[model samples]
Target chain A: MRYLLTIVADGMPEPEKLAVLQRECPRWVHEMDGRGVRLLGRELDPPEATTTVRVRHGETLVTDGPFAETKEFMAGLDIIECANLDDAIEVAASHPVSWYTAIEVRPFAGDLHLGEAAAAFARGDACGEPFLLVTWMGGTPATPVHDQAVADEGDGWRRDLDRRGLHVLGDALGRPDTATTVRVRDGSTLLADGPFVQGEDFIASIDVVRCQDRQEAVELAASHPVARHHAIEVRPFCNE
Target chain B: MTVKPDVRQAVDAAFRNEWGRVVATLIHRTGDWDLAEECAQEAFAEALRRWPSDGVPHRPGAWLTTVARNRAIDRLRRSERGLQLHEQIGREAMLDDITGGSTPVARAREIEDDRLRLLFTCCHPALSLECRVALTLRSVAGLSTAEIARAFLVPEATMAKRLTRSKAKITAAGIPFRVPPAHVLPERIDGVLAVLYLTFNEGYSATSGAELIRTRLCDEAIRLARALHELMADEPEVTGALALMLLHHSRRHARVGPDGELVTLEEQDRDRWDCAEIEEGQGLVEEALHESRVGPYQLQAAIAACHAGAAAIHDTDWAEIAGLYALLEDQCPSPVVRLNRAVAVAMGGDIDAGLAMVEALTSDPRLERYYLLEATRADLLRRSGALGRAQAAYARAIPLAPTDVERRFLERRLAEVRATGADESGPRPS
Candidate 1:
């Protein structure tokens, strides 16, 4: 995971804090370099030079300064890719500039080209590429197609995924013969049984398919339906 | 061919300058203090063996650290224990994406944290004060247990047990390795300064060595004091301790002879004294005094300043020294302080009063085994024209003395009393 450490150094005399950084940054950079870790660092101009723009309803709106007004302003940042949040935090916490400035560490969003809605789903896949897994869940219809029970069938699907270089993230048994769902709109609410909204068949459990994109995810989800009329919902989870 | 003395001196200098840095950097890379120290030592041994043939490397500290790191990694891959440690570290290494990012200063500082943590761990309160002092001298100051024991006038076995008990207590209590917070810094400073002072005193007047002074111990104590000052300059007591040490150490060059015999304070050539150290010590003392908070060290510095300020023995302000000793006695109240006060009193021409005070200390239990008490008493007796009694007192002191230098000084005094043949009962003329 990549962390963006936004250095916020407000209220400190600019020159004094800058001098500290000047003396400390070279040492810090050399230490990290010795460890074979390279980081991207940038110093931003003053807050007065900052501008924000947004296009909404086919109109462009420009603001005079940053997106938010706060006492601690972002003066600079370093992009560090580390093993986990812990490692990222360790690096950021030890930065020489951290003594005077606050380091706001946020994990970099993956799939930068994707819009917010799509990115949320795609980002998890992007982050979890190394450890992605595919499997199926839920009980089969009451037919004598195979001797294995629904739970056993799920285990079989997991074994098959494992054979294909995929691993099971998690699995759970569906609730015994009952399920509940709820929907809310405006100030009103609705509740139903049989998997909500009088669906043709109940979704006893969910199959979280690990794939690289929506097409692969849809394809994986298609092969796991318990009944002919049943439907599956595809969602994403991150391993990073 | 034998290695040139200059080459040996150069290598020794390199080791003194870079030992800590090399150990620190290696510890960062290796993540083990004991292993890092061993690895650094191995690298130095290799340098000693090869530098004579291949010549010394430029940037020797960096070269040594890099060589040690690589050797540690190679050794780790070769041994089962090393393999296990490597596996544990390798998991983290595999996931580390921000490589080559930290600076040498940061790495050195990180390694120094280990040393600081070792100091605190060695000084944990579960151990007795003796154990804490011994272990701190051994682990933090890097002195041997034998050296520490000699400094404290204890048997080597006793010191070894003290160190073992300290380490056991630390293990039992599981003291976390860290620098103490500001709240506990005073206590930590107290422990560190006590060890430094003891180490310096041992060097100033060695216990059993043929030589009167151990310059190695003196240099090590000075280095440790400097390190403490660097680490905690804001603490007034640290500055006071440094000032006290510097003032006393400024007289080192004038304290001995070419034949390695001790020189009495009055006979020491004032011109041979270190002027730079005297000036720096004065500056430190002034700064510490400005804080206006009096402590034992500040009192000692004041006393030392009295001596350093004098151009000759006659010009020494013994009265001011006596006053500072009195203040120090109130602040610390040790028998040693009172003994020092008597010396000042004698120098100020109250010889009879000083003799009375030294006589009274004979009954003090804390000083019963102390040779200095008898030695001081003999000086008073010699001054009062009691030659027979003074010679006998000197004889009593010789057996109790720990060092050859002290024994030699006592022998000389005894010979002086024998040669004088003055009236044994009456006070002598000044």
Candidate 2:
């Protein structure tokens, strides 16, 4: 369970105590975060720096003091994940803030109104999303049998994609042995017989597939038998 | 209004043997120190209440374990932490092997292993030395806060607060409740062994009090060391340390005379020594030496073995013992080790060599106030026929001696030197 702990304190604390807190609290925060207990925390500006704006019936009314007149104000806040309420209390009690101030803990509901795209992204659901998979193969010479195996593996992947109704469009390019690079510099055209950059591997194929999300595309690419000895890079298409 | 004597004895015995196990079992299952300790204590309290009328259970440890475990389960079920416990238990699958289709014997073994792990956790090197001692006494020895405070001569509230801080740090720092891995074993074992040795020494020769030995503290240290040796049978130093303590303790029966005067090793009655303990300690020393990788503790054990194995002081192999002390000094150099080496060298018939070593130690500020330094020098001087210097050294040491027994011993040596007329004409080193 996750809880937000609001550190409530009166006006300003003693400077010596504050100095001690400044030196030690951040270390505690880092330690708690390392333990995976604390998710995030931040110190808020003091009450004097607070600016409160009230929006009533679309009319904005600005005020000096942050909230209502109360005995204490929120000085800082921490979001922590714990076992449950008791565990959350335990974590909260360990905080240095609790030494001199109150730690108000409450359950965190998270943001519930994120739009469809963002919601899907948060859930890791790539439904109806498209991606491009760039298949890499060796530029090094291979036997005819190895070449045939690569072709057979690609075909098997295409068939599996078709069965899953995720196939969109894909193509196997000619070997890097037949590739060329063209460049124009200072109104002069230059040509090369191979890739411009020298590396052990080259792009051998490209696949455009529509799936639930990038996760599904990654799964499909990983399942491709060519990925056993080669590499498959799956990139989600950003349609803007 | 009266508690039955038999029931009280059973409860006390059970608490001594079963406290660590019961607390360990709960801590292993729950991962909550406070909860485990509280529930275990509650179980003991319940035992005290019911055992008289309800009759003692056939298997007291198991009964206590079951009752404490049930109490922990109840606490977990009602608290939010219970869900975390379940999740943790599920992930680790720690209880699965024992709880799922295991024999009663296997379950018993697992609980005993938990107690050993608990000791390691309590004596972890990450904790401060004082904290480690306090935690081990409380968790492993089943000493109450008041008892611990009284033992160490601290306030009860202070001891309680220290224990609370240590537990908080254990949880907050995520110190694991298990023995360290083999690679880190030596350093961690040093920490554990140091605690056990200190505990034993405090009991063997208490810093304060009229009594020379507190038998309970020595017993607890020996018990803990024996358990550690059992768990880490392959670690030679563990065996060495256990052997060293056992050998020293074997002579405890003869260490002090009937008049409560300090009995030097040469004057001690070998017939009063524990032959069984000497045999066990000698066996351990032999096995540890066979490992070939010697440590400080192993070297010290070998030295003790020479003393214990000998029938009399004349039969002792001082040369071999001196060689072992040299090896130990090389492994860990300290004034105490050097002093011991000097004594062994003198006993090995190299009196001048021992006198030279003690003279060199006179300039060391660390040992300036140490009474043993002066005492050892006094003995060496007396052996070399420098009776005047020996008497002066004994006078200096007698005032600096921490214990009454050691003071009396030094005074006796001073009287012997004066009576021999050697103090009248010998030149002083000054």
DockQ, all candidates in order: 0.01, 0.01
State the lDDT of candidate 2 residue by residue for B393-417, as single tens digits. 9989999998787888888889999
Q: Count the backbone clashes (under 3 Å) in each candidate.
A: 20, 3
Q: lDDT values of the candidates?
A: 0.61, 0.72
User: C-alpha displacement of B59 in model 2, angstroms?
Assistant: 2.6
Let me know the TM-score candidate 2 reaches against the reference structure.
Answer: 0.62
Candidate 1 local Cα displacement, residue B56, angstroms: 5.9
lDDT of 2 by residue, A93-147 (tens): 5666666655655442221121343334323354577655556577443222285
- Model 2 regions lying over 4 Å from their true place: A1-240, B1-6, B77-101, B207-213, B422-430
Model 1, residue B185: C-alpha shift (Å) = 1.7
The CA root-mean-square deviation of candidate 2, after full C-alpha superposition on the true structure, stands at: 22.4
Docking class of 2: incorrect
Model 1 misplaced regions, further than 4 Å = A1-240, B1-10, B24-31, B46-59, B82-87, B90-99, B111-115, B118-173, B207-213, B257-261, B384-392, B421-430
